[model samples]
Target: MAVLTERPAAPVRRRDRGARTLVNRFLGYAVLVFFALVFLYPFVIQLGNSLKTQEGAAANPLSPFPDPLTFAGFERIFAGTNFPLWLGNSLLVTVLVTLGRVFFDSLAGYALARLRFRGRAGLFAAVIAVMAVPGVVLLIPKFLVLNQLGIYNSYAGLIVPLIADAAGVFIMKQFFESIPVSVEEAARIDGASVFRTFWSVVLPMARPALITLTILSFQGSWNEFPHSLVSVQDPHLFTLPRGLADLVSGSLGKGTQYPLKLGAALLATIPVAVLFMIFQRYFVRGANEGADKG
Candidate 1:
């Protein structure tokens, strides 16, 4: 009698569970949307303020839209300053760094994750240890190294050290470890070389992780100021952040060139902004991947 009654109870329990799931999903989305706006509002203000004139921008720093749109700021960026040159430099550095991180970091990561060489564990441990080293503390050491290599004031110094990061390697290694071994095993059984298998088989499956690292590399190199500060003293070598810092620190003359400064920042931010907008799903996937791997 109890068994027969319990059969009907299954449907009732499932219906209640489905209702609870629906409510949870709705609440989750609501929280996400709210926080997204909160985090993103500053960029929105930057975009709007950049379009305002010098007076307008200074007067209304908090406004979301320019009262009267002015191209004066952008005009100054192009006409009065070597904005295009800095933009080009930033793009060049970002591309090379991102590519290097994606390739080298993944190779190191996969080796650390899968290969069973002597001292592999020690090497992986070293990479994690390196990641814990604070960036600011490395400032003096990096400068000394760059000077010793005679690449201190060159583009190479700015781009090379940033190419392969410890964090990227660690992230990739974690993701690689979480992946099923059967996939790599199948490729190996077909007589593929390790590099060939990794290049063709494993990396394809690591698309989410790769994109995440690429995006991080791009953002990091793009906003990099301290490295640029120590790497080169030449105005010609100034990336956007370096140039912007110069502008803010009275190099752009006495009063605030608010509009021009904001305009430059706006342009500088667009690439990462567009990337974040389009690859948002991958970002979420990457976050979840790290959580699972850890």
Candidate 2:
């Protein structure tokens, strides 16, 4: 019999494989860092320009360093403009809208998820359809309704229209469906009414979804511009975004006024940024939970 000696197996290229992986990881990280800087460059410019003199900002709007830094822009923001009023309105509207959305969205979500009612499926479908509709499409109708209701140019118009949204209801409903029905059934077995079960048992367990909704609602109301544009024309009723727009549109009159405008815009961005940073972990969890349910 011919001596059959299996040729030695080719040496595994483990070293080359490891080196390739290392190179790939480095490139991936490099690309990510590059994009991060690109994305953040505008904000960096915004900050730098906000601290610059008007002449300095105008000369070098793209510069990320302020030469002869000053606070005159911030001073002008408060002393010369209605920044304080806009801030107060934003806070009030944000808080009320967040609270209303959390309550109303959760109620609607639970009803759709667990309730046995006529048109339940159809209502849920309609809610989904509403989410698909571009909000701009509703602007004319929204204005018409608000005008008819005689609430235009008032806080009610600003606050009420934003209190609850189809998106919030959809988010809450998806999250609710992920929860085990047995949990609510147990509450019911102990004689909890439908509303009581929702309030005491279900809502408490839906903390992630609630936080997500609160953050979204707060951000939406804080940055609300189109709604404010259509709802209120009074300068006194202007929210931060609307006021910022007015500030940029020759409200301050002549000259670039770059520092003052950027400072005001920067101040407007802080609340939402801080809120997101504080609740970022919960927000991510909520988003993941919603995604998994979907």
Flag regions of model 1 displaced more than 4 Å. 1-41, 285-294
- The local lDDT score (0 to 100) that residue 203 gets in candidate 2 is 96
How does each model score on lDDT?
A: 0.88, 0.88
Candidate 2 lDDT score relative to the true structure: 0.88
Off by over 4 Å in 2: 1-12, 253-255, 282-294
After TM-score superposition, the amount by which residue 134's alpha carbon in candidate 2 deviates from its true location, in angstroms, is 1.0
Across residues 156-231, which tens digit of lDDT does each residue of candidate 1 receive?
9989999998888988998899899998899999999999999999999998889889877888889898899888
Clashing pairs in 1: none
TM-score of 1: 0.82
**TM-score winner:** 2
